[model samples]
Target chain A: MFAVHTEDLRKEFTLKKGLFERRTAVAVDNISLTVKEGQAVAFIGPNGAGKSTTIKMLTGILKPSSGKAQVLGLDPWRQRSRLVRQIGAVFGQRSQLWLHLPPKDSFELLAEIYSLDKKSKQYKSRLEMLIERFELAAFLNTPVRKLSLGERMRAEIAASLLHRPRLLLLDEPTIGIDVVARQRLRELLAQWNREEGLTVFLTSHDTGDIEAVADRVILINHGRVIIDDTIDGVRHYGAPKSADTGEPPDMQSLPALEKVLSDLFTAK
Target chain B: MLKTAQKLIAVAKISARANLAYPGEVLGRGTFLLVVLYIFLKLWQATYSESGQSKLAGLSLAEMLWYLTITESMWMSAPKLAQQVDEDVRTGSLAVKLIRPLSYPLYCLSANMGERLVRFSFNLALGACIALALVGPIHLRAEALLMLALSVCLAFLLDGLGHLIVGLSAFWLEDTSGLYLIYTRLTMILGGMLIPLDLFPGWLKNLVVYLPFPYLVWGPVHLLSTPQAELAASFLELAIRQLACLVALSALVALLWQRALRRVSAHGG
Candidate 1:
């Protein structure tokens, strides 16, 4: 079964214009999509393109105005509690960690929040592995406010994984980190997907994130999916080939790929 | 059930630790409480001497001061639940909270209670010291102290309900501070923070007796000052009334919260 499926799912927000005046705008307009289990799909769009709205709907944070949405074969809105148990989410703009406390303390709090078995050896081992894998031991005891943006992001990801969620929803998870930190995060996510078969649905402005982590790309604009294709397909479609020689342009260059994606977005 | 309890405990523990991390805030609050206590001592003394009476409504000057100490402790020690709610709603953090498996109201309640527990303990000690210095000592029984503790716990829960109501109003009202201002004053006058209900005219006192506001302060403070022999009878009746108020308030909060969740737009996301 698919990890996420939506059929004509839509959301309409009523904005108050003035006294006794209201205007309704469509945020997610009749979007039907699906992601198979273990697939890393990038949901990319410009600002105010309804990307965050869609993620919110899928995560049961917002109820849809019409149609249906199911995450892990459960209606996200109606069965939110049960669905949330099987999913972990991280939004870069907001944090779930306690800011005044250290990552280690927040991790313990999260473990309790998720109701993990304290007596289980596997739970302890898993936590230890995450701490090491995320390289959190170096500054685990440092308060979250004192941690660098890169360190905090790593700790945030590690905290999300505490529940052993099958599907991870990341919204702009690499927005403000340094280049090296961003690259490191992408690699860690890729490794996790490959080794543990973790299904990832990520929204990011950085095309580098798409190139490094996403095998499938879904381009959205005006609250609708403009293109759903493989990363290679997107690259080939947008590549500037030599007309006379019929040779494919260098696809490995990051700038070339980014330009092509932007050109495609503009063309659509 | 047990899992929910554990989650709440963890929330409270983290909140307590967070509040303690900044000692300056607590110190500032302690200083304010002492200042307020000093003002009350002088005012009550002047009123007693002017009236030329050792007792007003069966309360000596010492008894009245002790009563004020307890009531003020309840008032001053409450955590700022309304402001926290306003911040969450305004920032769209409420949406983030909804997505979690935890209940938003319960989480807020637990966190605030944790902070309140720490502040209340400190204030209680400070109030005791101030009372001892100002009014000397009064006769007290062990049973009366136990009943006083129970009354204070119930008073705290009742005060929480009042704050929850004001805070939850933020779903519809843009600013709840206006509502909170009215609530604070109403609780002070009718709930017996500024003056004991017994000191009020008979008709006003009788009317307030039927209101839930009095249960938060007057009932508890009265229990603390009640004579030892009368404690058993007074405790049973007051305990029953407090329990009923708690249930009613919980139901109202639950109903309003259900409606509020529907109206949550998560505006800033």
Candidate 2:
């Protein structure tokens, strides 16, 4: 039950430029790696470090430019419909849930989309349990746009898990969440993974999100992997020892993540 | 299918609630359309009175006013230029639709139709009621009833086509809003909502008859009064042309959407 495998998975984008500038940008450079079954993998990098581009290709949301990949024993790009049912993807920047409809309505909608009969008590019980655990009972009938961010994310997670998928892909899963809510989400993920043997591949800027959920880190920068190793290995490789003030020297002197990533790309 | 229809109904119901939330937009748009409609009515009357004219096309001033009112409401509510479609593509929201078993275009079509259903009903109740009070009951012959139903369905299809063009273009164009606006204005000006197509010169009418613009408004209204033989021929012509446009443009939309997905994945959308 291989969870993910890639062979030189590459993606490129055409550049919009003036007469003299380069005509393309390599958004995801050639890369190859595998995550075993039930492993909690963290893909971490500054924005535009090819993290999302790589995830999109893995989830079959986008195709690779010059390589191949497989997820759960299927070609993600070629067999998207078959692959989709086996995994759930949550995109924090955008949502799959209907804005005007209630969370329950969107859940039913997805159930219909996945073509699972609503009368199936097995699925019904699973959904109910998820709703309860995620604390969605309060806002089950509330329209999605009206739900608080934490509530929305909870419902979003619940919606994705309705089918008991074997794998979950969460992009910025804990973004915009308060500390307590983020912790709760991590707890839920860990429990579900242990109980159901579910595999989670997460990408987040929150160190806590990575620390709590992912044992392995795939650190990327400028569309290439800087390190792909165990979390401790990544830490030992050369994380900036925190200044006594608990802030990195890079952060004290740098504008933001965007600037940091830009500097990395420019210097590299 | 029932679920899809129910979903659309839900969309319509929710839109009604949303309208309540934004009272200002409802009031502002309603008043803007009414004032614009009133001015058109006054201008038409002034022109006819100045010419010492009474009627043309066997229609009195009141009947023409009725036509203008319905046209304006339909213009405001017409199903073209789906606002959500462009955003759906640019924001990658359509990805949500793709994972669903529901057909993508069909889902969008239903949601949009739900919205238009609300607009059409509101306009019929508000705009039509006021006009009938000022003017009178619009006489609908038996054949005219059929034509109205047929043309209105065709109108919906035309509106979908308008949105389809813009929605599909988003895959290729970085920003599609300006182009959609230009396209919308062209239809409004030429679709007989601004003025009766009959009022246009003979050559212009002939030219537009071949184009898809007249089917949007004038064709249906014209079918309301025209003889059976002529209406049948025109209806058949319009149906075929509309179907043709639907197929050709639908194919183009599919192609562009596929290419766009590939582009976004490669570009990190």
Candidate 3:
């Protein structure tokens, strides 16, 4: 079964004003896409392009206005708890940990929330070992609110992965993170992707996040999927060809990837 | 089941520990409330003396002043559920609460109750010191005192009900401040936060007797103001009314919670 799928997915919201104002917003316009099992799909869009809205819908945080979607062969809105257990999520720029609690304690709370087996994942030992792997032992007891931004982001990502879920959904997971932190996160994600073959669906404005992590790209604009292809396909289909032997533009430069997105979205 | 309760207790305890880190703010608010209670005591005493009646509305000058002091402190510390709900909606933070394997309303209730219990202890000490220092002693007969304790507990239940109703408005209205203001004013007038319930016209008192508003202050004030012999009969009647209000309010909370969750799943914050 497909790990994630959506058919004509759409989300509309009504403003709180009078009927005469007739203000309606189509946060996620009718869009369709699918991700195969164990595939890493990156959903890339501009700030107001309904990327977060789509993630929220698939996570069952919201209901689509008109569409069909599934996560891990289950309807997320209909079976939220069961579907959520199979999927791990980390919303960028928002720390789920209690501001006053230590990073280790926050991990315990996350473990309890996910109901991970205490016998197997004894929180203290497991969380400490996980932190050690990330070179985070020196900041073990520090409160999350007091930690540096990079360290805190690492903590957030670790907390989200404690249950070892098969599907990971991250929204803008590396927006303003430093190079070192981003690199660590990228390595961990790659390890999870290669060993566990975890399926990841991510939304990011940063192309580096997409390039370093996702194998396939899904570009969205005005709430619609304008292009869905591999990183190489994005270059061939969405960018101009180089003069050298009529080859496609080089894809290594980050700004070049962004330029392709801007041109495509602007054209719409 | 036990584990969930333990986790909730841990949450409550940890919340308390974190809040204690900011004791200075608590002390300041307590002191300000005490000062306000003291001024009201002097003003109420002068009013009674000028009236020249042995009792005004069946309460002695001292009894009336003490009642005001207690009610002022309690009402100021009313449950803050509406503001919490408003904040969750405004910040899109409610999504975090929803993803957890817990009922959102229960979470809010436990947190609010734990915080209120802490405030109850702090304000009690501070208000008692001011009351005793300014006015000698508050006379209480055995039955009146017993009913007085029961009445305070009932007031908390009533306050929770009021907050639940107000907070549920957030599902529809973008803000609950307007609803909160209306509820507060109604409680102050009908619940006898300003004027005593007995001082209201007989028909008006009869009308509000069954309402939760009166349970908030009317029950406590009447218990504190009346003698032991009079309170014995009133206690049985008031207890039944408060019990009914609690049951009805709980059912209302459950209904609203279902509606709110349904809306949240279908719509964005």
lDDT of each: 0.84, 0.74, 0.75
Question: Which candidate leads the pack in DockQ?
Answer: 1
| Interface DockQ of each model | 0.54, 0.32, 0.31
Better candidate number, 1 or 3, judged by DockQ: 1
lDDT of 2: 0.74
Model 1: CA > 4 A from native: A236-257, A260-268, B266-269
Please list the residue runs of candidate 3 whose C-alpha ends up more than 4 Å from where it truly belongs after superposition. A15-18, A21-25, A36-38, A101-121, A133-143, A175-198, A241-255, B1-11, B53-66, B137-154, B217-239, B265-269
Model 3 agreement with the true structure over B152-193: per-residue lDDT tens digits: 777776686678778777888867899999988888889888
- Give one digit per residue, the lDDT tens place, for model 3 in A1-268: 7988899999887765776776788888988888987888899877678887888888887878898998889898888878777787877766687787678767665665566555673655666666875566778678777887778877877777677677888877777888888877877776667767889898877777788888999988888888899877776655434534565556563236666777776775
**Which docking class does model 2 fall in?**
acceptable
Query: Candidate 2: which stretches are off by over 4 Å?
Result: A19-22, A239-268, B1-28, B78-83, B92-104, B228-234, B265-269
Better of 1 and 3 by lDDT: 1
* lDDT of candidate 1 over A107-217, digit per residue (tens): 888888888886799889988999889899999999899998999999999988888889999988998999999999999888888888999999898999998999999
Cα TM-score per model: 0.93, 0.86, 0.85
Colliding residue pairs in candidate 2 = A113-B101
Residue A135 of model 2, lDDT score: 89
Quick one: ranking by DockQ, best first? 1, 2, 3
Best candidate (score: TM-score): 1
